[model samples]
Target: MFAARRFSLYERAFGPVVTPITSIRGLLQDFTTTAAYDAAQRSRSNDDYFATIHHISNIVRRDIYMERTLNKMCISKIVNSELVYRVLRSCSRSGIESFRFFNWARTHHPHYDPTTLEFEELLKTLARTGHWETMWKVAHQMKVQNLPISSSIVSFIIEHYGKKDLVDQAVELFNRLKSFNCPQTTEVYNSLLFALCEVKNFQGAYALIRRMLRKGAVPDKKTYSILVNGWCSAGKMREAQEFLEEMSRKGFNPPVRGRDLLIDGLLNAGYLESAKGLVRKMTKEGFVPDVSTFNSLAEAICKSGEIDFCIDLFRDVCKLGLCPDVDTYKIIITAASKVGRIDDAFQILHRSIEEGLRPFPSLYAPILKALCRKGMFDDAFSFFSDMKLKGHPPNRPAYTMLIRMCTRGGRFVEAANYLVEMTELNLLPLSRNFDLVCDGLKNCGKHDLAKRIEQLEISLRGD
Candidate 1:
């Protein structure tokens, strides 16, 4: 009977059961994937496009041997330039996988070459990930194909090199742009100037500016703005102000971003009086600085022990009919909380909500945390409940804070309930919270409850 059974199994191995279960599973997956492919092709939503690209790239990265199969299954029929561009954009986080897919598409497929924007995205991915060897290979591919190297690409390369303090490398790239057939435009000049200033090479940047002038490249407002920003960030307020004045005299207004950078720099350098004066000047000159700029000044004032002045300034700005953004409210709320004026914080919260501003979780966290630390559990829980009622529930940090507070106060049951809620919400409580809860429960002689909670925590973690 055993011999007859072995012979039957051997015959089946050469028949319908020849293919393994794994192979069958793969076939089923391929069938499902075809449906996904059809859906992806018909998708018009940006989120769907990104998710599709991410999904395809993930498959390619899953197994070295599966890339060809995945490409044949999904990417082979893709001929849309817009779709390809979106795929390249989605590859920003996975440089190697992106490079592999790009190479496979370009070499094996032969129907799709990298577009200019695709190449740009690839270079950006390469730059962000420090994949210099592959970057060089991609650049060589561009060169071989006689692709027109863009000035923006040149600037991108130079800016990245400058960030790494590789000034010589950036300079070499600038000098070699002619070899790449990229024209040295005024924008390119400004980019190089910005790179020099980024490395604090003001002397080198000034020389480059002179060279640009000699080359008949007129410096634009961006050029002066970069210089002003560089100097301001370096704490050379005098130089920054001089450049700002120079820009104005040359019939160029420093952009709002530049103005904000200058304000932040001044406030950070303890030049509060100077920063306030600049804001006043800006308002007088018909340049109403944004709320964020004003927030920076207010925060600096609060940090300098002038919380009252900061609050007054916030109110005065609102009276000017300029809507205070979430950032502005956060700054004032934080300042009030720091001064133990929880009532003031809540008052501002109500006023902001009454003014039709949506309160995000970020706006609630600091207030909840501050109240919890002050032993004002009633007020903290009140705000937490209000957050949920307003359809903006407290997130991980808020819950963690409450859990820790409860456990420390020997409220083990409350802490465990919060922990359970965190697990249900898929928010992992901090390790310290677990420790505190376990120890608090044991100290209360709830040994069985403690054990059960420990097992629940383990199960939640899939251990």
Candidate 2:
């Protein structure tokens, strides 16, 4: 009894009991001839058969008697067969976590199978989903069990985890790959560098770039663009510019659009002179300035109250045989008007029209307002009439400006007539315009006319 119990304990602790070959053959023949086994074999391919066998092994392993019997049978039949490797690969892809069993089988029973492709696919899938810990376990299994893992596979894992911001895991895997004598490729360095830069870890990014250079991995234009953008974003315009210069010296042209972005960053940070200088340098480099670049420069100048400089820049653009678009004219007009240069503002309007540029209402509205504000009502009215005759009728805002100017200049009859015209044009008179008309009539001592204006305002409000 004592010997039997000891044997049972050994079997339970280790594996299943090995039946004799005669008994195993009998069992195999019995199952093979059975309708159930025939149907299963006919319906499932060899891949699915192995999958089913592994699943059954798992289930039997949970039972003490069945586990001992199955383990003994597997050992007897040679655990690390080609069929077993396919089964293991399938389990790994299916997330069965039975790879450890395959590791044990391969360790204790030597066998080789050329299924590295499937294993690599599994590793890539796992890595893509940020399963780094599983990836580490699989890598260790592959190394210890003598399974093949390629450099491309290792690099793929590293790149994937790097993109996920799992830098420690990526580095750990990278070190393991180095132990495998895999050289760091340019793709690997680029992935890590970009990842570091994405997190704004410029120190890490810079170090990685230097390390890659030491590894004889030449930095490309993309690498420089990333660093330059990072520096510019961090308000290190000097550093960004220096890097750009370095890139140029190295026979690389960093993207011209990057210069525009750098200029915008500088301008937004109140480094107007640096922004302007950078734009000038970019222009001198024969990089054509995009509309947005010009707009940013113009806006920065206007914000700094450098209206004269903005006008000069627009003039310079014109002198370059580049006809200023309506938007350009609008910017110039706004900048001039903001500085009380009404004459210059109108000069831009006339020039735009003469250049065959269609005048948009937005362009004319502000100019008319500037004229009215400067007490140039006759000039404003004349421009409005000219615009109307030219088939670009004054809009609501323009008519509002005219009505306001008329009332403010004590022209009550003109104000009233303009109000009627605005209504005819379906442009509702604002409350301020009504107030203006009332005040104009009262100021002229026309009390009855003032009352009439107030009554009309009430009627309009009711409608």
Which prediction has the highest TM-score against the true structure? 1
- The true-versus-predicted C-alpha distance at residue 17 of model 1, in Å, is 43
Error of 1 at 251 (Å): 3.3
- The whole-model lDDT of each prediction reads 0.74, 0.67
lDDT of 1 by residue, 1-463 (tens): 4223323432332233223455667756876877777766677566766776767666655657646676566656664556656766766776677788677667766677677778778887886776767887888888988887789878887787778777887898899988899988888888888789888998888788668767877777677767766777677888777666665675555456557767866765577887888877776665656777787788788878988777866666676655788788888988887788778888888888998888887776778767877877667666777788879876888788788877766667667767766765779888788788888989999886677667665644545
Model 2 / residue 136 / CA error / Å: 25
TM-score for predicted model 1 compared with the true structure: 0.62
Best by the lDDT measure: 1
What TM-scores do the predictions have? 0.62, 0.50
Off by over 4 Å in 2: 1-200, 203-229, 233-235, 242-258, 280-288, 321-323
User: Alpha-carbon error at 144 in model 1, in Å?
Assistant: 2.2
Poorest 10 consecutive residues by lDDT, candidate 1: 9-18
